[model samples]
Target chain A: MSTPRPLTLIVNGEPRALQVEPRTTLLDALRERLDLTGTKKGCDHGQCGACTLHVDGERVLACLTLAQQAEGRRITTIEGLAGPDGTLHAVQKAFLAEDAFQCGYCTPGQIMSAVACIREGHAGSAAEIREFMAGNLCRCGAYPHIVAAVQRAARALEQETLA
Target chain B: MMDFSYARPADLAAAGAALAAGGMALGGGTGLLDLAKLGVARPVAVVDLTRLPGLDAIQVSETEARIGALVKMSRLAAHPAMRAALPAVGQALLASASPQIRNMATIGGNLLQRTRCAYFRDAAVGSCNRRNPGSGCAAVGGVTRGHALLGVSPHCIATHPGDLAVALVAFDAVVETWSPNGQRLLSVHDFFLLPGATPGQEFALAPGEIVTGLRIPLAPVARQARYVKLRDRASYEFAAASLAAGMSLGVDGRIADLRLALGGVATIPWRARSVEAALIGEHPTPAAIAAAAALAMREAEPQPDNRHKLALVPALIERTLTDMVGEPA
Candidate 1:
């Protein structure tokens, strides 16, 4: 094995520095090294979006991203969504209100993706939401509720922006 | 994944030098990283191309649209200029994999994505000719519902799992690349090699050659182009059979020009020139479209489980053409 290299990323608005192997994926760096395990690793491959997170405000599959690629970039995992005072973000609150999860394994990634979807203005309709959120797979079959939660969260985010 | 050295080169010359030494060019890493994880690809070094400047520009003019190879699929699909110039390109990209994937997958990476054959993906399966040359193809006799039907060789029948290449081929796009020999341009048709005896040799690009950009010449009928993809699910899944069709109508309601290409039915993105030839000056009636569609797949050779593609290919072609001409679906 090669020597670990020092890498730095502005993760969740904090400058995080860590030593990582060249092959360490962003998903592993977040979950294993940083102890932010909210991003799940379903399928490990890019086929499943269980490791979805935001890189510079765009939703990307963390498992497919090498840690070195995230260098000097802002990465927002599900752990970073809520306020520092433990106040759930609007999307999290909407997901809770809408009951958008069952087993909840895929919820973190789904919620992360949903927040980005709303921010990107792709949550205009339920069908559009489903099309955009197709990356995150929920085996528990909470798609209908998940769509509802995204709609509710989009509205809340809009109101928050207005207020 | 294997332990390999990674180098992020900010210049094309550095990336080219690394690639010339047998290091793999890493773009987005959506597909290559997964293959590395599966042990299908074992590179000694990875040349990261993300930091290279001017490789992600999308310039659209009156005559042609030049898209950087590193442009993300999501960005290209949502670009208003591309939508106005070439709707098929956007449609093909949007009809592809899911959103998060689209955000990370590069245009060059999409064109060079590996086959999604079950046998090829599972390196442990031990019988994919593409994965291990001369090992024999497991999909030939095993489960092959998704195998190629048009350009299948006895050695391999894995379908090319890309929608963008199909649309590019239909529009006659040109691929620009930089290699050890400097810069060059290749037509999309000549870019993807047919999987014959050497199923592993999928691209016409030389070792260490990095695709830099793609140029799609604009046509009068480009905005009328349509990409129709039929998959198992409405989203995220690979195409079962897809069609990228475009046409321009003359004043007399005749076909002025036409372009057609098929996906998920061939070893490469299959250009339907036969269908295009049959419809080029003919009035695009239902019978004429059916005849042209029939000509499109007349040379199809389907295996045991994939005979449905023979019918599906022509049906998709006819439907796509009909829809392109503003006929009722």
Candidate 2:
């Protein structure tokens, strides 16, 4: 048995405190402890990126990351992607506009990864988006839609910046 | 999963102390945590190496490029100077893992990552020499498709699954390490050990020693290198049979210098010295390149399932050689 340590994680611009064991992964902490179930756990060994989230503005897999290691970092998940008033983020809106999901189980992770992919400046073309977003696997074969959604979101974000 | 304690050490001394006390040093935790989940590694405690300073700098001089161990793979691959100067190293990093994993994984951790043998990963499997000493290798007759061809013993035939190390080995990079005893440097080629009777012992690191960085010489070959990864997929996949090759031509257009190393097809990052020797001092020709490239597999002992790699290695080497010569073969 391991002792539970106090961990204060900065999630979506807010500090959420919890007591977690040393072996508790960030995926489990977000879903089971913090009630942030939007970040789904697909393969908990970092092979699948269904639990993709942002730590300090960079995307990383939550399943392989220990919750204790996320201290003092700005963590963002799928639930926090939209505006506080419930307006969907540009990526989220583009995902809907492109129908980038079939079963919808992988939507949140796809959206989260797509957001980071564009921000990382890897969404310049369809091939680049496909290669960068290859981490997030979707069993429903939504890659074409996902690429379109990323392209749409990239254009939207670029226009917003220009505006 | 086993229960273990985690510690955030302030400096290298504290981190070494914890490691000396039967704790594993966690860098990115990408490899260690995954193996721990499978019960492959059972550490009693882990000390995080992220908070330590000065180990994350990328220093480039006129003579060499020094990459700190704690630098993330994504940051290094995306670095402008590294891509411009060491494109093979950058391509290797970009081709190794997914974006999310590259974002979290460190360069040191990437070099020290374990082999992706199925028998070794599953602790439930009994016959794995790398995982359990005195146990036999189940991968030899079980599933030999991904098994190594070059550095194989009766005990183990696991492939060293790393991309960056292969390119570094081709470029004569030096691995720098620190220990409670002292600081030391070793050739990256010698850092990886051949799996013999004791297949469990992997690297040449001393007890409680940690890799600090790697220093790569800025040679003509290093400047004009490329990493060709033949994998099952285009992205987020390990190499099936990859080649890291570099060549420099003389004023007469002959091969002045050449270096070759293989990944995903050998037990260690294999430097194709025989191939390099045969190609040097010869004019780039179809027949000459073919004969030299075939020497890469002179000593390969392939099994039933992996005999395809026997055909793949020489062809990949020839293709890379042709690419270096700026011709179609």
lDDT of 2 by residue, B47-72 (tens): 89987889999987767899999999
Residue pairs with backbone overlap in model 1: none
lDDT of 1 by residue, A22-44 (tens): 99999999989999999999999
Docking class of 2: high
Looking at model 2, the pairs that clash are: none
Model 1: per-residue Cα lDDT at residue A155: 95
Cα shift from native, residue B133, model 1 (Å): 1.8
lDDT over C-alpha atoms for residue B312 of model 2:
95
lDDT of 1 by residue, B198-255 (tens): 9889988887789999999998877778889999999998999998888998999899
Best by TM-score: 2
Q: Against the true structure, what is model 2's DockQ?
A: 0.91
